[model samples]
Target: MSSNAALLFQGGIGVIGLVAMLLFGIPVLLVGPGLWPSILLGALGASLTYAALLLLTRVPGLFPENLERQMQGLYDFASSYSPVVLILLSLLAGVGEELLFRGAIQGWLMANTDPVTAVLAASVLFGLVHYVSFTYFLVATGLGLILGAAYVLSESLVLVMVWHALYDMIALYCLLRFPRWFGVRIVDPVTNRPHE
Candidate 1:
């Protein structure tokens, strides 16, 4: 895709995040009460997420065959972009998606229902939003649960944002750089390496 098109999509994601924050009153962002503590918690969350990613990709028969196709598509698409653009896209997704999913969806649910209910419902919605395949939906939902737990534990939207962004950045790098990890074998024409 063209850079301008990518930027436009990135901006749309950010706009959605802002809208969610506005609706749910999460404007404080990094200035929220537990900022310092959340930072450490975010790092911890990222570590846990990374472990999950590794397990999902590395374990045989853990993910269905379709997931290999899903990863192959992701690798092909991601490998087309410059690494910097990919990082920026992942960062936007982290911040924007967290704001919408954790800050708004889960936050509102917490107010209207129980905490566990809120997390599950929001996680389901998060999974639905990123639905590329059933396997992908499950993966996204599981990831959402992790992020939701981080948000609840720290009571900080920024924590999940940081955790998510770091995880995406690293995951994207790995997905593109090591397609074989996900049972893919295509070499990225742009990078002249990895699965194409």
Candidate 2:
């Protein structure tokens, strides 16, 4: 499929999943109103995840070059669109993925298992759905762990949604505006070693 078509398909699927979760899963989970504290914690969690990525990027050979190339290719494709489209796409990804992984799956798991197990299961599923690569899967799983922890702490999906959306926007902007920073072959400033 064309990139645009793929994005549309993803967004449409996400919307459908979110709606289904809201209509069916919410009542089944007995989810209550959002708590301010949980929301704040969720925001913190998202910020921390972004910060962690920033730190990781600074380390030489931390992430595979192939991943950078793949990400750059994606960024190049996304760069063809307007800012509004990018924002909307990011929002779609954030909302749709969170709804399915955190809201529906995690909620269901919490009902039958412990919170830790639920979070891990949901996180693993989240990683698997990406189907990018083992490295990417691991990265996604780590991010999922952060998201899950935030949910457990704040019990607020909205907070995580905002966090995820903001994170995506920041990442998209960086990838578009500063492509050089993501190069695979570079000297690790701290270790003085080649990244590749």
Candidate 3:
């Protein structure tokens, strides 16, 4: 499918996912307002997963060059945007992407199948829906796995939403403020060395 067409399709799916999540998640949230701990744990879990992935990419013999460039580009773009712009971007991403991938898709999977199957299936779908370059796909899939696990652990969409927003905001800040510290150069994923 054309990129535009694919995006539109994904957008539609996202809307559906949001609605479903709100329907089921709200009740859970209302019943157990004290599930904040789970939510916090979920956020921590996601952060660890992301860090691990970054470290893995730095490991020798496992990195992909194209993937590294893509990551660097993403960091550069986020770093370039103003704080207000980044906030807006994060809000939109948290609402749209989270709703579609974690809320709607994950909700459906949890209802129809076991949690393990649901998480794996939803993560795959989330990854496939991007239809971007391979590196982008891998990053997104890794993110999906982290987010999916968060949802399951917390059983609260709100926690994942907040975590997602916070994560994006921090990434944007890091990209903008400490670009060099974060390794601005694109590294070859396979060799874990800077790409020349």
Residue-level lDDT tens digits of model 1 in 19-50: 87677675333525477767777777787788
Task: Give the Cα-based TM-score of candidate 3 against the true structure.
Answer: 0.70
Candidate 3 lDDT by residue in tens digits, 7-51: 455466557765777776622221122457645654675476556
**Candidate 2 at residue 193, lDDT?**
96
TM-score to native of every candidate shown: 0.85, 0.78, 0.70
Across 1-196, the per-residue lDDT of candidate 2 in tens digits comes to 4657757865876676667677765422212345565456556766777778878868878776466766666666766788887888778877777877888888778877889999999999989987577777888898888878777776677766767777777878877776677653444679989655
Best by TM-score: 1
Cα-based lDDT at residue 144, candidate 2: 87
Error of 1 at 191 (Å): 15
- Weakest lDDT window of 10 consecutive positions for candidate 2: 25-34
* Range of the 10 consecutive residues with the lowest summed lDDT in candidate 3: 26-35
Best by lDDT: 1
Clashes of 3: 5
Higher-ranked by TM-score: 2 or 3: 2
